[model samples]
Target: MSPQTCTEGFAYDRRARQCIDVDECRTLPDACRGDMRCVNQNGGYLCIPRTYSDTSCILGYTLAEDGTCNDIDECETNSHHCNPTQVCINTAGGYTCSCTEGYWLIGGQCQDIDECRYGYCQQLCANVPGSYSCSCNPGFILNPDSRTCLDVNECEDEPCSHRCFNTYGSFMCNCDEGFELAADGTSCIDLDECSFSEFLCQHRCVNAPGSFSCICPPGYYVYEDGRSCEDINECDTGNNTCTTAQVCFNFQGGYTCLDPLQCHSPYIEVSDNQCMCSAENPACRDKPFTILYRHMDLSSGRSVPADIFQMQATTRYPGAFYIFQIKSGNEGREFYMRQTSNVSATLILARPIKGPREVVLDLEMVTVNNVINFRGSSIIRLTIFVSEHPF
Candidate 1:
C-alpha cells in the first residue's frame, strides 16, 4: 500500500481512489477575508472582494502592515449606502442597513408598525414613528407603571356642594338630610318641605335652608312635637282686653268681649248674638232682617285667597235661592263672598293685609223665592283682628 500527496485545495479520497477538490469556503475559517467571497478552483481557492473601490485595498477593507486585510468601519467614514433616515451598522468589509425604533425593514425599506393595533392601553393608544404611548379613560389616570389604569378621585377636588363620595373610576355627589341635588347634580338646594304635602304642619309650614319648620297660627302655639299645634286660652293667660261693661268669653283659640247690654234702637235684640230690624220703623225697609256678630284673629302675612269664614242660612225651604255679596268694609277690594250653595256662603280674603290692623266686613246673604214672591236678607258683622306677628 502506498500514500499519495495532493496539492493545496485538493484532498486524497481512498474510497474513490483519486484526489478530490477541497471546499475551502467550508473547511477554512478565514478562507474568505473581510466579507470576501471564496471561490474554489480545480487545485486552489480564491478570496473575491465584495466591494472594490479602493486603490490599494478592497473597499470597506484596509491593507494591514502584515499584508492581511482588516475590515474598515464605513459607518465612521460615512461611506455606507444607508440613507439619512436609516442607521448604518458597521460589519466586516461592509455595513448593514437598519431603521430607527418602531420601524421594521422589509425588502430594503423601513415600514411603520402600528402598535395601537395590539391594544396596549386600557382606553386609548397612540403609535409614534419609533415608539408608542398608552392613555386612560375619563375619570381615570395612568399609573406609574405606564400600563396600568387607576381611578381618579374627583372628590379630592371638592366638586360637590354638599358631600362627595368617591367610587371606582367615578365619583358621586350627595345632599344632606333636608336638601336635594340640583339639576347640575353637584349643587344642593333646599327641599321645600312645605311644597311636598299639606299635612306636614298642623297650622303652617315654613322652609329654610337645608331644613323646615312648622309654625302655629294666631291663638295657638307649636306643641311639644315640632309639627303639631296646641290652642292657647287667652282668658286664662289674662291676654284679653275686657272693659267693665263687657265680660270675657273663652273660645277654642281666642277670647271675646261681649257687653250684656241690649241692642241699640231700630235694631231690636233677638238673641245673645243677633239683632232684628223692627218692621214698624221706616228704616226697616232697608235694614236686614237679622244681624249677627262674629270675631276672628289672624296672623300677619297670612296667605291670600283664604276662605276664612262660612255662613249658613237658617232657612232650608225647598223653593229658596240665595245671593251673597260683600256689602261693606271692603274698601280695598280685600274681601269677596262666594255662594257655595242655596243656603251657604263663604268669605274669601283676596288681598293680604299687613298687621296689626283691624278689618270689619259686612257680608250679606239674601234668600228669594219667585213662587212665594218673598225675599229676605241677613247680614254678618265679621270682625277680624290681624296680629303683628306670624306664629
Candidate 2:
C-alpha cells in the first residue's frame, strides 16, 4: 500500500491510503434542500439540488427540521424588545407587533383609561390595565358589585345632636337645646329665655331659653325651700322699744304700738292713741229686762191669763212657736219665737227693767198645724239683760 501525498505529487492510491469520498446527502437528507443529492468523488462531497414543485422559504425564513419553513420567536428571548403596549407574535421567519385590546398601543404599556364612554359602570367606571374599577357619583358610594354606587347612610353615625338627616351624598345634624343649626354646622340659635319658664330656675324663676333666674319679694326672705317666703320677726329679741303705755304688735313686714281703747277688755297698757281696757273697766256692765206675757191658739180666743207671765217660757212651750212684743216704756223690749225646731230665741234689753210697769208684751199664734198637740194657746215669759262689748 502507498502512503498519501499532497497535491502536485502524482501517482498515489487516493481511494485506498488517501482521503475517501463520503455521501453526506444520503445521511442528512432532511437537512439539505429537497432536490439536492450528495456526490462522493474525492475527499469532499458536492451537492446537486433538484428543481422543486413547490415554492421555497423566503429570505427572512429558514427551513425547519420537518422540511417546512418557520419564523423565529423574538418575543421569547426578551419581552423588552417590543413596546410595552404591543404584543409580538412569531410567524414564518418574522414577528408581528400589535397593540392589546382596549389600548391605543402608543409607546407600549397599558394605562388607566376612562370607561365612561362605553357606560361600563352604573354611574362611573374607570378602566385600568387588565381590569376596571367602579365608583358612584359624588353623592353616592360604590356598591358591593363595585360597578355601581349606592346611597350613603348618614343616620347610622348619630351625627345630629337632635336629629340626623340623610341627603344625596351627605347628612345633616340637628340641634335640640333651645337652638337651631344654621346653613353651616358652626352656628346655633338660642331659644327665648322668658318662655318655658317652668323648666328653668325654680321658685319664681324666669327662663331665657338658654338660661334663667330666681327672685324673692321684699320684707320676706326666700326660704331654704326656695319656693316659699318667710316673714321677718321684727318683735323678736328685746326690740320692745315701744313706750311703757303702748304694746307692740308684730305685722308681716314690721311692728306697731296700740293704745288702751283699741286693745279692748283684758288689756293692761295702751298708748300711741290706741285704747286698751280690762274686765274691771267701768264701761263693762250687765243690763237686765222683763218679758211681757203672750199667748197663742187659745180656744175661746180670750186674752192669755196673767199667770203666764209668772213662769219662764222655756218649759211651757217646749216645741211651740210664740211671738212677744214688749212695751217701748222698757227700752223698746220685744221678742219673737223661733219657728225652726230645736232652736231658741232670747229677749235682751240694753238696760235693766226695775218694775212691772217697765214693760208689756202681746203674744199670739200665727199658725196651727196637725203636727202640734197643744190644748190651749202657747204662752211664754222671760227675763233678760244686756251684756257690754261682745253684745
Task: Identify the candidate with maximal TM-score.
Answer: 1
Q: Which stretches of candidate 2 lie over 4 Å from their true place?
A: 1-55, 58-186, 197-204, 207-209, 221-391
Give the alpha-carbon lDDT of every model. Answer: 0.77, 0.44
Which stretches of model 1 miss by more than 4 angstroms?
1-61, 66-68, 76-86, 145-147, 233-250, 255-391
Model 1 misses residue 254 by how many Å? 2.5
lDDT of 2 at 18: 27
- By lDDT, who's the top model here? 1
Q: What are the TM-scores, per candidate, against the unseen true structure?
A: 0.47, 0.31
Over the stretch 111-208, how does candidate 2's per-residue lDDT look in tens digits?
A: 43446666778886777764577778776888777777788887886666567778878877777776767666735566566565553433366545
The TM-score between candidate 2 and the true structure equals: 0.31
Scanning candidate 1 in windows of ten residues, the lowest lDDT window is: 1-10
Give the per-residue lDDT digits (tens) of candidate 1, residues 1-391: 1224654555656664334556766788888768777755434556876664332555456788987778888789987777766677665556555556576554445676677887777777888876789999889999997877999999999999999999998889999999999999999988998999998997789999988999887778889889987768877788889886786765545567877747776898888778899767898877788789887877667898899999988767778788998889999998888888877888888888877777899888888888888787888988887765544
